[model samples]
Target: MEQPNSPEAAADRVLDAALMHVAFDGWTDATFRAAVLDSGVDAALAKALFPRGGLDLAIAYHRRGDTLMREALAKTDLSSMRFRDRVAHAVRLRIEAVEDREAVRRGTTLFALPLHAAEGARLIWGTADAIWDALGDASRDLNWYTKRATLSGVYSSTVLYWLGDDSLGHQATWDFLDRRIEDVMRFEKVKAQLRENPLSKAILSGPLKFMENIRKPVVPDDLPGRVMDRFRPKS
Candidate 1:
C-alpha cells in the first residue's frame, strides 16, 4: 500500500512542482502560488509546510541535495583515498547532486537578498558540517568551527565558479575545486606549523588557551545543525 500524505510528502510535491516554474519565476511568491496550484496540495497544509513559501522551498531543495550527497557518501568506499582526496570527492559529490542549474541560480538570487543572506550562509555552513561529519571528523574543539568555516568558504567559492563554468564536463570547476582544497590544506599546514613552533606557540599561548575553551555547539538529532552534535567530547 502507498503511504499516507504527510508534511514531508506535501513539501516534496510542492518542491517538485516549484522546480518547473523556478526558471521562470525565480522561486518567488508567484512560483510558490503556481506550485501550490500545480501540486494540488492543500493551500493551508502547504502554507504550514512552507511558512516562508518560496524561500523555504529553496531551502528544501538545498537540503534535498545534501541528503542525496549523504546517501551517496555512505555507499562509496573512501578507505583507500587520502584525507584531502576524500574531502575533494565529497565536495564534488555535493555539487554533482544538483540536477538543475537554473533552479540553483534562482535560489541563489532568492537567498542573496539582505533579509535572507544569513539564512543562506547557515545553509552553506550546514552543508560543510554534513561533509565533515560524513567524512568521520572527530574533532570536538575549536577545530570543529574552523573546519566548517573554512569548508563553507571553499564550497561557496567553488559553487560560484561552477555556476559560470562552461568547459567540457565541468573539468574546469573540478580543477578550481582542487585548487581551493589545496589552499585550505596549505592553510591547515601553516596552522599546524605555528602550533608546533616553540616561538610561535609561546607568543600565542594566551590566545590558544582561550581557543581551547571554545567547544562545538550541541544540537538535538532532529535539528538542522545536528551534524555538529554527532561527536561527544572524548573522555
Candidate 2:
C-alpha cells in the first residue's frame, strides 16, 4: 500500500532497485548509485534513505522481510498451536517472506566480508528478535535475552540451510529447521534438569575447583583406591 510518491515510498523504490543490483554488485556503493540512477530518483535521496549506503540497504532489505513476516503473522491464529509449533510457524513465515534467492545470496556474500561480518551478526540478531516479537513473546527480563539468543541460533542455521536447498519446495530445509527446534527443546530440558538437581546447586555454590570436574563422578576413581589402600594395614 505504498503511496505514489512519499519519502517512505521513495525509499522503497530505491530499495527495490538496490535488490536488483545486489545480485550483480554485492551491495556496494556502486550498487547504491546504480539503484538511485535506475530508480530515476535524485542521487542525494540515497543518503537520506540509507545514510550508510549499501550496508543500510542490506539492513533495510532484511527489515522488509521482517515486515512481510509480521504482516502475514497477523493473519494467523497461533493460539491453538503449542509454543514450539508456533515458533516453527513464525520462522517458516519469516523464511517465506524472502522471495529473491539471488538477493539472499548476495546479502550473504556481502555480509561475509570481514568488516561486515559483525554487521551480518547484527542483522541475524535483528531477525531473531523480530521473529520472537512477531510471535507475541512477552518476556521482559533475562528470559527475553535467553529466548532471543536461542532463536538466533535456530534462525541463523535455518537461513544458511535454506540458502543451499534445491529440493522441491525446500522440504529438506524445513526438516532441518524442525531438527534445530528440537535441539533447542532438548537443551532447555537439560537446563531444567540441571536446575532441579542438588549437585548443580553444589556446582554453583561450591569452590571453583569443584566446577572443573562437575561432569565426573563425585569420588575420584584413583583417589578412592588410594585412600582405601592407605586405610589397610601398612605391610
Candidate 3:
C-alpha cells in the first residue's frame, strides 16, 4: 500500500532517516530498521518507500547528488570555459554538494562488497550519465558510451580520493582531480588524432575493414527506469 504522503515526500522522509544512520551503520538491515524507527513512519510504510532497504537509500543518495549537481551547475557560468573544464566542474559539483563525507565513505564501503559491486557500478553509471547530460553532450554513438565510461572512472577515483583527503577544503583532492582530467583530455586528443590519421582510415577501408563491420551502439535513455524495474516487486 502507498503511504499518505506523495511518493516524493515519503522518499524524502525516508531519506532523511537513512542519511542519519548510513554513515555509521553502513546501509545494512540494522540501518534500515534504525531509519524506520527514526522516521516515525509505519513499518510497512517504510518498507513500501524503500523496498530494497539500504540499497534504495544508496540510490537515493546518488540521485540526490545528481540533483545537487544539476542545480549547482545551473548557477555556474561555464559558457566561457573549455569543454574539459565544464565537464570537470560538473563532476566536482556533485562531490562538493555532499553534506556528509562519511555518507559517501560508508557508501563506498558498502558498494565495495562483492555482492553489492554490480549495483554500485549501476549507480556510478547513472551518475556519469547525469553529468554528461548536464554537459549537453550531443554525441549519440560511440562517444556517448565512452564519455560516460571515462567519467565514471574519473568520478569514482575522485570520490575515493576525496574520502581520504584531509587538506583544507579538500584542496588536495581537487588538485588530484585536475591531473586526472588532464589525463583524460590528453587521451581524448590522441583518439581524435587517430581518427583523423590516414593510416587509420586506410585500416578501416581495408578488406577486413573495422568501422563498417561494427554494429551501431545504442545507449538507452531509460536506464534508470530499467534499473528501478529490477528492484520493483512483481504483481
The positional error of residue 50 in candidate 3, measured at the CA in angstroms, is 1.1
Ranking by TM-score: 1, 3, 2
* Candidate 2 wrongly placed segments (more than 4 Å): 1-3, 205-235
Worst 10 residues of 2 by lDDT: 212-221
Please give the RMSD to the true structure for each candidate, in Å.
Answer: 4.5, 17.6, 5.3
In model 3, the Cα lDDT at residue 205 comes to 61
Candidate that would win on TM-score: 1
lDDT of 2 at 159: 88
TM-score of decoy 1: 0.92
Q: Candidates' lDDT values, in order?
A: 0.92, 0.84, 0.84
- Give per-residue CA lDDT, model 1, range 1-235, as digits (tens): 2245877788889999999999988888899999999999999999999898888899999999998899999999999999999999999999999999999888888788999999999999999999999999999999999999999999999999999999999999999999999999999999999999999999999999999999998756867766556575632
Worst 10 residues of 3 by lDDT: 207-216
User: Which segments of model 1 are wrong by more than 4 Å?
Assistant: 1-4, 220-235
Candidate 2, 1-235: lDDT as tens digits:
5578777888888999888888878777888998999888777776888888888898889889988888898899988999998898889999999989888888888888998899888888888888888887776655676788799889988988999999999999999999999999999999888768899967766553554443311355357457676466642
Candidate 3 lDDT, tens digit per residue, 1-235?
Answer: 4456777677777788888887678877788888888877778878887898988888788788888898899889998999888988888899998998988888888899999899999999999988898888777665677888999999999999999999998998889989999999999999888779989867756643543444426556469657566567853
- TM of each candidate vs. truth: 0.92, 0.83, 0.85
